[model samples]
Target: MLEKDRFFEKVIDRIDHLDRNGLKNLIENLQQKQRVLQLVFEALDEGIIITAEDRVVTMNNVARIILGYKSRQYGNFQEMDKYIANWGLWNILKFLHGEEDIRKEFTIHQQQEPKYYLVEKRTIEDNLVLYKLVDQTEKKKLQFQLKNIESVAALNTLASGIAHEIKNPLTAIDLHTQLIQRAVQKNLVCLDESILQYIKTISHETKRLNQILNDFLLAARPRQLKLSFEDINSFVQELLLLVKPELEEKNIALREEYQNIPKNFIDKDYLKQAILNLIKNAMDAMEKSSLKILTVRTWYDNGRDSTAIEIADTGCGISPDQIQKIFEPYYTTKEYGTGLGLTITYKIIKEHQGEIQIQSKPGEGTSFTVYIPIHKGHKLLDRPL
Candidate 1:
């Protein structure tokens, strides 16, 4: 009994000692822990807020910034509460109260700016709620841009269809006009050569107008591909033969590097038009260069199930800023350019399930690489034995 009483006395003494310094040290340790947590919260890029059962207890600098609260006024959570009342944060808080792991993307009006925030709420062990805010403004902006591009592309397609329908009749009218003017000129019946010249001028102007319309129509329409298994080497050789005279006239040196490429599934006529436009653009850009060298290269890109054809030029390169906008319709840097060639080229390539990539720099040169898928079907000329 005496030993038991002695042990109880020792325990009482120890408890008394713990009452003094132990409480003081415990308070200090908690303060230090809070300071460390504050530092960590301030260092993070994402905004963070910690709320007690009734009110917000702590918030990071980023959170203050996102909430449009100044550093000096951060201690007052009531002001932030009032500001967020209209922004649907109050509703989020209500949801967080009931839910365990909550996530939502919501728009908040802070300082007159409509900011998109991805809000994540997690319930801590102590019943405190941790709210994380991530800004999605840039993501939303990119989405808007993509939507606009799609709309523009659809409009371009519609325009092309209308242009195609108009072109055939325009061509017929142009031809008939030329024939009538020629017959009138041959029959010199009481009319001077000036009158005949006026008729000829009408025919010439109509022809030019027809050409412009045709170019515009082609730009707006999606091309129908006549799928054929074409030998890349033979196709390119034939294309060069057609453009050889023009290149020679311009004194541009032509270089061909044909790699062993598999048969490509392509619309021959549309592919020819695309290549023709690219080569023509290259040749035109080389008019001011000292040594004009146009390189046409074809090879298979092994990493993909397709073939790539590259048309590079040693002419003046396009500007960096202008490169992205080059595919946009009616956006041109040339004096006499209709600005639809590259746009049409892009459309045609897209229809073929192909890709066109351009690399250029000012005064250096430009290269356009086109990738077309290999046809998985039998060759056009292959017959059953």
Candidate 2:
């Protein structure tokens, strides 16, 4: 019996030793995995943020650098304010705190400029939230650049078609005017005032037609931007004043939401003209609408490093099909519409390395958003004078 008991004790001791070795190995493996994860997190290029419950637990270097956060420790919510101000980090944080699923592209106004990010949120252990922010600023600009190229090409084609189709009629009109003038000269005394008035009308219309052709050609061709610094807030205020009389005639309510933003490098004259053209279009659209409200707002987009002007009108909005073709030359719904106004507006904005987006619904309203870069060097497309 003593021999059997000793044997059992030895076996138990051996089993205990093996269990201790296995536990040690498991701990080392876990530590190795943690170290590897830390290294991988540091080396990542995209911004990655991990939070334990509502407090930031760990954030990668890229997240800190890209988001302009200098501190590695952000466990305290209050400590995050300084860096979060510019990144609009509070937006995501708010959503996370609410335990809402956020997987979308969101624009955050950072320092008066708009920054876009593809933010994805996932929860770990039902408490920690991980937010991944991918900067889409450059990608969006590239997309705009591509669209501008397409627009320019279309403009070139339109210009060629206009020169061929419209110039002959203009020439014919000019020759007819000259012939009428010569005939009048030969029979001055017989010419009645009514007949003379008719001739004057013809001559005046001919001159106006010639001017329209000139505008079309100018709009179609590449323009050399005359860059200048201007305060957009003051510029917008002055511009609204000029159109105040017109708005009053239509009983339109003008609303201005102007943010005090810094000056932008822009061609003041061209930009002013473009904005005026847009306002005119809005007025035309509102002619028959029940509500005549024109809202103009200006702000800066920090993410894109640009200034933006948004003109919204509670007018008879455009149909989806017509909206796409609105930029095409001579494509107009109005009987007397030249259709080149918006085209020229598009050209000027593109040359300024800017973007124009229109949102409209038939019988609802229309909003035209124009984005202009703050720096003159942001020329994605060349516009030669």
Candidate 3:
């Protein structure tokens, strides 16, 4: 009976040892997983923070920088709470603790600048709360710009309707005025020379008005694009030739940097009009500069899968406040300007399913870039200058 009891005791002792080994292995595995999770949090671009019930437990480096608390220790809840409260992050904390699911985006004013953030909070197991922050200031700015574009587009449609209704009558009036002037020139019956001169001036001014209306109508209306395959470099070169005399008279140096561009789809006439408007604007902007220089460049933008045409000028750059309104119809900074040039340019580029972007700073010059897609079966025409 004693030997049997000893044998049973040895078996029980072996079982206990095995159980201890299993627990040690499980603990090591859990530590490895925790280390991996920490590395992942550090590597993420978006800021991340974790809280255990009411205290800050951990934060990634991105979170530290975003909150302007880089020197803070990992689990410093009291200090973090202070900073968060000062920066208006207390609302976010309340949302996390509350019963509501919190996901919101808002702008925080910082030193006269606005920073946008997308905040999200979710509760995980063990009463842990995770807070994620995404910076979206630039994206928000772009969205605002796009909204402005849409408003302008709607205005363009209304203007097009008005212009179409008025154009026919204007044309008829111009024709009649010209005919009456011709009759006066031929008859000269009891006609005072001053009256004749007045008639001639009226006729000329009417024709000028007609021409301006035509330009406005063209800008407001959708263009019928005659797409063709053509080398963008050659196309721009031809355009430069047409504008060479004007540039030469102003003493503006024309610089061309053409990359090896593949054949792209474009409408010859419409593309020329857009390019011409851009170059003319550049010339006008540089009128007062000591070195009146206009640079034209064409290249492929790999990220966009499109061809880009850039017109840059060493000119009196636009003010930041006024830059946003430059593309609006009938908005001009120059005297005797119709303000239709840029409006027309923008419309034509949009018709081509392209995008136009302008970057300018006060006293730093400006650059206008137009990006158009590259596709097959586009058309090109050689027009007489």
Candidate 4:
């Protein structure tokens, strides 16, 4: 027990021999403590009820709210149970009527979405049961999300199989287009300029389809990673240089913050692709905004034992609904977007055992933060896997 609590107990034990003022002071002190506890109890979001010998001793304000408790002058459990029969809380009433301390789950689905709670009955003292309510709606939603992820994984496997079957026909089409292009170049077959343009369009479309198929295969399957310890700052710098002209043309201000960090074991090419996708997304989001600022930041967190890259933009931010669907395959808001960008990026990060985080406000801006472990336990030697 705490020193103050022990001292209080000693005083209470010696109460019979105390003077009148001493007893009065002890009573006032206890009342003050009770008042503080009551204030705290009422402020809590969880429902708490303390009942003794099947009689309602006391319940918190939250308990009253959850139970739809209207002030009925109830001195016993029977009266409260009758009042709550229509509140869709008969399970709680049933649990209270039992002898042994047991647990009960209260679920009400007649509302818009399901609300779940666990009303645990614990015996703090003889015939004194404490029922605590814990909300589990978010937990249920998270379980559904996990199931959806599994479904997505299954779909990816199926897509990979289908993409493989399509490869032979696509290769044949590409080869035939190359032959036709060669014949046109040599003037072996006379064709109108308009027909030549049509041929070019076919060849271009064939190449585009081939590229899309490659992306699908890559995103579904793990690549043979050439893991090496490389400086990520210079890597990001090179990418920024590659996109410099586009940034200049768009009149978007660029800000780079590269913190001194240790080299991480990574597939430079794959990681570059991931970060580039994020940068391009940031650029697209800022296309309609007048004040365009693209910020790229790199730092290391000793606590997490990870390195972080943050790309932020002053542009139209993603809504909550859009953010949820962003990583799903073929989901995008851009007019001409293929939507495989984020899916591939997500796959690459997963291959490295890293994670991506996103933060955004509707109109303000958005930030994408990627965390990669600074050191990995397994260094699968530098070779094609």
- Candidate 4 on 291-337: residue-level lDDT in tens? 99999999997877888899999999999989999998889888878
Per-model C-alpha lDDT, please? 0.78, 0.81, 0.79, 0.83
- Which one wins on TM-score? 1
Among these predictions, the greatest lDDT belongs to: 4
**Per-residue accuracy of model 2 over 84-170 as CA lDDT, tens digit each:** 534475556555566676788878776655777787787866777787878887888789889998997887777768775887898
The root-mean-square deviation over C-alpha atoms between each candidate and the true structure, in angstroms, is: 8.9, 17.1, 8.7, 6.7
lDDT of model 2 at position 317: 93
TM-score of each: 0.68, 0.51, 0.60, 0.66
TM-score of 1: 0.68
Decoy 4 TM-score against native: 0.66
Task: lDDT winner between 3 and 4, please give it.
Answer: 4
RMSD of 3: 8.7
lDDT of 2: 0.81
Model 1 collision count: 2
Per-residue lDDT for 1-385 in model 1, tens only? 6975885586567766677677687568668977997798799999888777746777787877766544443333445555552345545555566667778898866676676778898878576778897778788878989999899888877877777778888788888777776666677344577877787787887777777787787777544557777897898889999999999999999999999888876778888888888999999889899979999999998766678888988888999888979898888888978888898889888877778989997786899999886643234224221
Name the runs in model 1 displaced over 4 angstroms.
1-46, 50-56, 60-74, 77-136, 157-165, 188-193, 375-385
Model 3's alpha-carbon lDDT is: 0.79
